[model samples]
Target: MPFRRKLLEQTQRDIKRLKNKGHKPTTLLGIFLYGGTLGFLFVVPIVGGAYLGLWLDELIAGYSEHWTLNLILLGIAVGGYNVFRFLRDKT
Candidate 1:
């Protein structure tokens, strides 16, 4: 009886937590959309940084990839931050 009561209390607490957070059941389409959004958020900055760095390197007239690498790293940092912010906001 004590075990059953504890289990029921735990379940009730979980349900309350979900309800308080406005948790929604995920669907296939929703899954796809969320994944796509995450991908876009993560990739766009990298691609943009690559292009901009390439352009700058070309303008510099040198055989170095310093700018491209630096920008790509920066892009990755930005993308990570974006994903972190998105997840934090969702939760």
Candidate 2:
């Protein structure tokens, strides 16, 4: 009986704490906007890297995709890092 009473009191306190925290509810529009921003952040770096790689390849008279491939890979790494940082900070 004593243990059950203590448990009930603890549960009430937890409920009170949660109610006081005042967390805002998430909306559908907020979710969509966040998704769109995340996508844009991810894509911009990759495309920029591809474009830069292509330009570098064109500058040199070589029939090789070395620059393009390297830059694209670099871009992927950068974009992944950006997304990771954004999410970490957001949370």
Candidate 3:
């Protein structure tokens, strides 16, 4: 029937429009994955390094002022290194 043929034609046109629009579901998923990966790569190590230094300082020096200052310096160093690497990385 003509109605069936028109429905098929409309469906084909919709598929072409969708393809041309470049709005696939995978595009959003890829964006999210890339964002999450970059966040994890950049953030997790800095936080983990600070926490590790804090734990080590507490275990070794108890409640001393030197321990507190040294741990803070260690965290600063780690943060500085992270910033430096980020600035240096081109890829």
Best candidate, TM-score-wise?
1
Point out the higher-scoring one by lDDT: 1 or 3: 1
Clashes of 2: 0
Better of 1 and 2 by lDDT: 2
Among the numbered candidates, top lDDT falls to 2
Alpha-carbon TM-score of each model against the true structure: 0.73, 0.72, 0.42
Instruction: List the global CA lDDT of all models.
Output: 0.89, 0.89, 0.68
Least well predicted 10-residue stretch by lDDT in candidate 2: 17-26
Model 1, 44-90: lDDT tens digits are: 89988999888888888768788899999999999988888998898
Root-mean-square deviation of every model: 7.6, 6.7, 9.5
After superposition, the stretches of candidate 3 with alpha carbons farther than 4 Å from their true spots are 1-26, 62-91
Clashing pairs in 2: none
TM-score, predicted candidate 2 vs. hidden true structure: 0.72
Rank order (by TM-score, best first): 1, 2, 3
Q: After superposition, how far is residue 1 of candidate 2 from its true place, in Å?
A: 45
Q: What is the lDDT of candidate 2?
A: 0.89
Better of 1 and 2 by TM-score: 1
Q: Residue 58 deviation, candidate 2, in Å?
A: 0.6
Sort order, lDDT high to low:
2, 1, 3
